[model samples]
Target chain A: MAWTAPMIDEVTCGMEVNMYFPAED
Target chain B: MTGAAPAAEAPPIDGSARPFLPRGVRLKFCEVRKSWFLLAPERALKLDQTGVAVLQAVDGERDFDAITAHLAAAFNAPHDRIAADAGRFLAALIARRMVETA
Candidate 1:
């Protein structure tokens, strides 16, 4: 079997979780 | 003024070193991609078959030498070549704080 060097790719996802807070009066 | 953080030092990799994935890092298969990924906090690195084979051998019990030996036998490749490649790969991960040696 032919062996190749390990390769890595950075993965990006669009979905993200964020906490929302109301503006303080 | 703020400055860029210093680069992390590369970890020493030798035949005697036993490497393992540290906490917060995981090797998982993605169903959507049908590939393996080295998942870290807020980051994911897609790995090919060769990468998967190398990482799978890192069981924390086998040193670098043994790991290379196993890979060589499995792939019918040269021990020296596998040693060099796997060592470099692991070293890169170590520098990124993805893998640790014990």
Candidate 2:
């Protein structure tokens, strides 16, 4: 199934995402 | 940007579409098809028949239990692992705004 993914350019294809989770207060 | 963690990578979906369809772990809306689809991205590709099994398992809410069971059975893996993976996908899709929670 093909879909036109709606998102900001940086969040679009081929970008490496780095995530960091902070402590919950 | 302040101290907040960087945004995670996730898929995208229209918020307006949620009411018409309640998505689970594997299913996603196919805007062009006007239908829902099961996404098993290369990150977690299923074997051939498992693909078909995944498709059949997502009919609706009642189908979730069956779907979870099917996933465990098809992958020959532990239930917890299957559950975690499924949860991860669902959470990722939601975070990406690819699927909305209703």
Query: After TM-score superposition, what is the CA distance of residue B39 in candidate 2 from its true location, in Å?
Result: 9.6
After superposition, which runs of candidate 2 have C-alpha atoms over 4 Å from their true positions?
A1-25, B1-56
Record all residue pairs in model 1 with backbone atoms less than 3 Å apart, i.e. clashing: none
- Among all windows of 10 consecutive residues in model 1 chain B, the one with the lowest summed lDDT is B1-10
Write candidate 1's Cα lDDT for B1-102 as tens digits: 112222223544788989999986778886756878787776666777778999999999999999999999998998888887788778878877899999
Q: Which candidate has the top score in DockQ?
A: 1
Q: After superposition, how far is residue A12 of candidate 1 from its true place, in Å?
A: 4.8
Q: Residue B22 of model 2: what lDDT?
A: 34
Which CAPRI level is candidate 1? acceptable
Task: Please provide, for model 2 over A1-25, each residue's C-alpha lDDT reduced to its tens digit, 9 standing for 90 to 100.
Answer: 2111111112112121111111212
